[model samples]
Target chain A: MTGGRGSGLARLSLNQKTTNRWSVAEAVQGCVRAGLPAIGLWREPVHEIGVLAAVQLVTDAGLRVSSLCRGGFLTDPTATGRQAALDDNRRAIDEAAALGTDCLVMVVGGLPTGSRDLPGARHSVVDGIAALVPYARERRVRLALEPMHPIFCADRGVLSTLSQALDIAECFAADEVGVVVDTFHVWWDPEVMTQIARATGRIASFQVCDWITPLPPDALLSRGIMGDGHIDFRGLRRAVEAANYLGDVEVEIFNADVWDADPDEVVATVTQRYLDVVLDG
Target chain B: MTGGRGSGLARLSLNQKTTNRWSVAEAVQGCVRAGLPAIGLWREPVHEIGVLAAVQLVTDAGLRVSSLCRGGFLTDPTATGRQAALDDNRRAIDEAAALGTDCLVMVVGGLPTGSRDLPGARHSVVDGIAALVPYARERRVRLALEPMHPIFCADRGVLSTLSQALDIAECFAADEVGVVVDTFHVWWDPEVMTQIARATGRIASFQVCDWITPLPPDALLSRGIMGDGHIDFRGLRRAVEAANYLGDVEVEIFNADVWDADPDEVVATVTQRYLDVVLDG
Candidate 1:
C-alpha cells in the first residue's frame, strides 16, 4: 500500500524516534524491510549497540545514515558545566562522523536550572556552538542547528526560530554549520517559507512530521505522523527542494501513539503518507 | 502585605481571566479592594452583565478599562465566515469604545477547520484586520495583534512572533493596528527585546504572565502567575516601557490553579508578584 511509490521512496528515510520501541538493529532491519534507503539514528540506541557495530550493521544493510540524533545542550550557565558540555558535544561529533552522516542535529539547550535569563542562555548556546564548530569542521560533521517549537524554549531548546538559528549558523561556513528544517517544529513560523529559501545550501537535513493538537501531557511527544495534522507537507517539501536540499527526506515523528504501535505498520503508514502527502499533493 | 506597594499599584491592571470565577462587579470590586487602579475586561463576562452595565460597574468603581479581551478569529475560509467575524469585530469595536478603552486584543484565528493552508489562513487574518481597520479607527479602538507562542499558531493565532505581528500591524496607522506583548507568549522569543523596541508607538497592551512547564492537559491554561515560572518579567516590562507604552500593565493568567484559587487571594498574589518581580526586580 505504498500509494505513490516511485522516486519518492528513494528520498524517504525513517527517523529512529518514530519507532521508539525498536533497537538500532531492529530499526535498520525495519528500514530495509520497508525498502527504505536510509535510517536516522538516535544517540542512546547507537551507544547501546556501540557506534562502531551500529555503523557496521547499517553499512552491511546498505542503509545510508541520514543524521545522528543530537549533539547540543550547550546552555549550561557555569564555566565548568559549559566545559563539560563542550566535551560531550565533541564526543557527539565523533559519533556523527563514525555513523557516516555529516549531519549532527543540534538541540541547543534551554535556561539553566531555575534561571530565567533567556538572552544569556541563548548567548551561551551560540558560544557553545562556536566552540564546537572547529571540532565539527575538523571531523567533517556538519552541526545541524534544530530550531525547536517555542513550546520547548524554556526547558528544551531556547533557539526558537529558523531566522534565529541562521543568525548563529551563518557565523560559520555553510558546510561546517547548517540548519535542520523539521516541519513539526517549524511549520507554524510565518517566515518559514522565506527562511527555507534563505537556507539554500545551509539545509543539513529536511525532516517531516505533523503538528497535532490537544498536545499530550508530555508536550515533547506531541508530533503526529504526516497527513494526520494541520501542516501543509507538499508546500514545505517543495520549499525545501527549492532550497537545493537534495538530502534524505527523513520522517521523524515523536507521538506516543506511534511509539506504542508496531514498528512495521508505522513504517508502512509513513511510506504511504510520505508519497501521498509530502512528495505529491 | 502589599509588598512594594506605591507607584506600581497604579500601573497594575488585573485581567478578568485571572479571576475566572468573578463577575464584572466582583472583578471591579476586587480591583478596588486590592487598591489596583484598573481591570482588563473579557467580552464574555462583560456580555454576561450587558456591556453597558459592565461599563457602569467599572466606571463607578473608579477603575480604568485597560483593554478588551479579544475581537478577532478571522481565519475562517468561507466569505460568510469572514464577513460574520468582521461584523462581530465591529460590535467589539463599539463595545471597546462604549467601555472607554482604545485597545482591543485581536487573537487572529488558526488554520481553518481541516485545512492545512497556513499561508492562506494568515492572509485571511491580514485581510480580516484590514477590513476592520476603518471601523476600529472610527470607533477609536486599536486592534492589538497578539503573536501567540507557535504552539497556538495552528488553533489560536497564526501570527507567531512580535516581528511578524509588527510586519502586519505596520501596514496601517499605529493607532489603528498594534501588538500585544504578552510575556507568557513572547518571553521565549529571541528577538522579543528588539521587536518590543521596534513596537514603539504600536505597543497596544502589555500583558504579564509566567510560562510554567509540565503544561496542564489543556495548553491554553498553561500560563502561570508572575514569578511562578521562567519569564524574566522585569526585563520585558522595562522593554515595553522603553517602547513608550504608557498604559496599564495587565496580569492575565489562565492556569487552572490560579483560576481555582479564591479571586481575592489571586488578586493579592498578583499584586505582590507584580511588585516583587515585574516592577522592583
Candidate 2:
C-alpha cells in the first residue's frame, strides 16, 4: 500500500500450506501484516471457518484468493472410490466458487491400493476429472490439474508431467480445466521449458517451492524456502511469464524447518527471498 | 552345462551389485551352480580382483560377461573434477574390454557440488560420452546410456528419460553408443511406451529391478527384487524384447534387506521372481 506501484507484492501469494500452523484468520493476518496482496487457501482451514465466512474473512481483509488448495483424488480403481472422489471434488468446486477463487488445484490420486496398473490409474483420473467438468464450469471454477513429481506416481498422483496433465486437461476447455506449474514437482523435467511455453493460457496456478537435496525420509517434505535449495526460480518465473500466465506466484515451501519456524518470520523470510530470487534477481 | 539347449538360465545375468557379499569368483560360481550362463560385472569388484583376473574367473567358469555396470561420473563442474571422472571412466572402459563385454552401462553423474545447473550437467554428460565414443568403438564396446529415474537426477544421473539418452546416443552408430532399459528407472514415465518403441536396435542392455515404496533414507538402495514392487516387469521386458533388444535380463536389486541376505538364496529368490513376473507371467 506504500507506493501503489505493486512492484514486489503485486503477483505474490502465500499458499496456506506454507505455514502449517497458521489458521485461516492467522494466515490472512500474516499476509496483511506482511503487506502481501493475496493468499492461497487450503480446504481444511476454509471448512473450519465455514465457506461463506471464509469468503467474508478475506473480503474484509482486502485480500485476493489466488487459488483453492485442491480438488482431486480421482484415480481410484473401484466404482465406489471413483464415485466418492467425484462427489468430493464437486463440493471442492463449490467451496472455490464461494471463496471467489477461479483455480482449484487437483493432485490427482495415485494408483489404487496394491495395484500396479499405472495406465489404468491414469485413465481413472481422466474419467473422474471429466465427471467434474460440468460442475466446475457452471461454478466458474477452473479445475487445475497438477502433475506431481514422478516419485508420487504410486501413492499421491498419476499425473507426473506437465505434458501428461495437459493431455488430461485437453479433454475439456481451458476454463473447465487447466494445469498447475509447481516448481517443486516439475523442475527436474527435461522438457519443462517447452512444456511451460506450451502451457500458455492453460496455466491455472504457479506455485514456487525450491528442491533441497539429501532428501529426508519423507520425500514430500523435501521442499525448502526459495533461496535455500537448487531450483532456478528466475529461469522458471521468466518462462511462466513468457507463457502469458498472469497469476499469483504462491510461495509454497513444505520443509519441516520452515513449518517449525514462527509464521511471521516465515512470511518475512520467504517474501524477501521471493523478491530476490523470483522477481528481481 | 548339462542340457546345452540353453536351459532355464540362458538369459539370466546377475548384476554383481545385487549380491554385495559375492566376490567375482563367488558370483560366477553361484550363477553356474544355479544354472545361469551370464553375469553382469561391476567395476569396483572387477578392480578388486584385478580386471584381467576378473575376466579369467568368468571365462574359466564358462560364464558370459553381460555388461560392465558403469563408466560415468561425467557431470562435475570443475575442470579437475571432470578430468578425474574421465580418467576413471577410461579405466572402466578398459576393464570392460578386458572382460569381453560389449556393453558398458553409464549411470552418468548428477549436478556438481553446490551447483544447480541441471542442463549444464546434462550437457557435460553428453560431451563426456562423445569423448569416450572413439575409445569405446576401438574396443568393440557400446557406451550404454542409462537414464536414471528423475528422483536420482539430483545426485545420480542427469539423463532422466529414454528420449534424452536416445537423443545423445543417436549422434553415434548403434554399436558405438546405445541405451540400457532399466525397469526401476523408467516404469513411471508416461512416454515410456513410445520411447521404448522408438529405441529399437539402440537398446544395449535390459536391467530389471522393482521399486518398493516408503523408500529408505539412502534412496540409492531402494530397489527390490522383481515382483516385490510396482513395476510391470513382463510388460517392460516385452517392450524391450519387441524393440529387438536380444540381451540378458540383469537382476540388479539394491535393497539393504537383499544386501544382508545370503548370496545364494538372494540369487535363487531373484531368479525365481524374475521367471514368475518377467518371463512366464
Candidate 3:
C-alpha cells in the first residue's frame, strides 16, 4: 500500500489537515498507504516539518503536492497592516513554489478588527491580491483564491461566493490567480454549477468536503465525510469535471470525529466514501 | 405604558421570537411596557390564544402587529408533502389577515429528507408561493420571503440569498410578494447593499439581529445583540431605509443567553441596543 500504486484514484489527494493529529510524515505515509497520489499541505504543518524536508517527505513517498493551504488574509485597514499581510503571502508563495505545488489557496481574511466595512475589506482583498500577483507569478505559484462559506465571512474568508472570487480573479491572468471549487464552501450557492463551468481554465484547485449540520459551537469543524453530509458529491464532481479542472480532488474534512480517529483508518474510510459518493453513487 | 403611544419608537417592532419564552399576551404587554408600538407575531403564540383573541389582545393594548412569523416550508418532496405545506400556508395567510399584519414572513424549507435536489426544492418554493400568492393577495397579506443564512440551506431554508429571494419575488407584484431584509441572514452577501436598494418597494420588512460567531450546536440561537456581534447595523439600517422601506425595524434575536435572561430585561436591552446600533451608533 505504501507504493500508492492504485485504487484507481489518480486524482485523489489526502489533505493533511483532515487528519489534524498526523505529522507531515504520517500523512505522506497514510496517503501512500491508501494509494492517494497527492496531498494538500497547510502552512503550519509545512512550517512544522520545514518546507524543504516536507517536500522531500512527499517526493520520497511518491506523492504529488496538490496545493499549499493558503496565502491571503489581507483585510487589514492600515498601510502597515496591508504591507505585513502581503509580505506574509509572499513567503507563502515562496513556500508553495519550493514545495512544488503550483496552487497556493487564498482564504481572504474577513472584516478588519473593530470595523464593519465589508466592501472596504473586499477591496483590500483585491488590492492585496493584485499586489502579490507579480511576486507569486515570478515564483510560478498560482494564487488559488478560495471563497469560503458565507458563515466564515466575518472571521475567516470574506470571499464568500465563487462568483465574488472569480470577479476578483478576472483582474489578473488566470494562470497567475484563480478560484478553488471547494464543495463545502460552495454547494449552497444557487449559481455554483454555472459558475463552476464558467470558471473553466481558471479552476485552480478542486477541494471536497461534505457540509454536515447541527453545527457545533465552533462552526469550523462542521465538515464531514462525503456521504455523511448533504452535498451532492457526484453532481459537484461532474461540475468540476465539466469545468475542465483536472487537478486532484483534495479531501479536506474538518470534523472532530474524523480528526480524532486513526489516520490510516480515517484515510481508508474517506477514500471509500469518496468513491461511493463521487464516483459510484 | 400599555397605551403604547410614545417612547419615540414609531418604527420599531419587538419580534416575539427574540424573547422566545414570552407568551403572546406577555409579549404584547412587554412591548407596551417598553413603550414599543409594534410587535411581530409568531404562529405558535397566536395559536395559543386563538388568532382572533390574539388579534384583539394587541388591538386592545393599542399595539400593532408588524408581521406574522412565517408561512412557507414549501420544499417538502412528496405530493402530499407539498400539498400539506401549501395548505398550512393558506391557514397562515388567513391568520396574517386576521391579525391585520400585511406581511407574512416565509422561511422556506431546505432540501427534503434523503434528497440532494436543491433546484427541485427551490422550484417547490416558487410553486408553493405562486399557488398561495393569489390567496394572500385576495386577503391583502403580502408574502415576505425571508432568505435564511447559507448555513441553513441544507436543513432550514434553501433560499439563501436576497438576490435569490428577489428573483422569485419578482414574478409577482412588489406589494403582493416581497422580501425580508434580515441582517442576521444577509449581512455577508457582497451585493446585499445593492440588492437592498434594488428591492425598493419590494422590501416588506427590515429585521435586525447581529451575526455572532462560534455558533452554538444549534445555529438557530447564534444571533446576538446588535453591538455584540460583527454586523454593521447602522450600515444595514441605512441601506434598508434608503430602499424606501418605511415599515417597522424589527429587533429579532435568537440566543440561549438572551432567551434565558428575564424577558422584560431582554426587551429593554434589545430596544436600547437598537437605538444605539441603528439610530444613534
- For each candidate, the alpha-carbon lDDT, in order, equals 0.91, 0.88, 0.89
lDDT of 3 by residue, A1-281 (tens): 33332555888999998998998998898887778889999999889879999989988998899999888899998989988998999999999999999999998998888788888899989889989999988989899999999999999999999999999998899899899999999999998998898899899999888887666566888888888778898898888888888779999988888888888999998888877788754
Write model 3 residue lDDT over B159-239, tens digit each, in one string. 999999999999999989999999999999988988998899999999999887656667888899889878888888888
**By TM-score, highest first, what's the ranking?**
1, 3, 2
Point out the worst 10-residue segment of candidate 1 chain B by lDDT: B1-10
- Selected candidate, larger lDDT, 1 vs 2: 1
Tell me the lDDT of model 1 at A273: 92
- Native-contact recovery for every candidate? 0.87, 0.60, 0.75
Q: What is the per-residue lDDT of model 1 for residues A1-281, given as tens digits with 9 covering 90 to 100?
A: 35446456998899999999999999999998899999999999999989999999999999999999898999998889999999999999999999899999999998899998888999999899998999999999999999999899989999998999999999999999999999988998888999999999999999999998767767988889888889999999899999999899999988888999999999999998997899865
* Better candidate number, 1 or 2, judged by DockQ: 1
lDDT of model number 3? 0.89
Q: Spell out the clash pairs found in candidate 3.
A: none
Model 1: DockQ score: 0.82
DockQ category of candidate 2:
medium
TM-score of chain B of each: 0.98, 0.96, 0.96
Angstrom error at residue B86, model 2: 2.3
Model 1: docking quality category: high
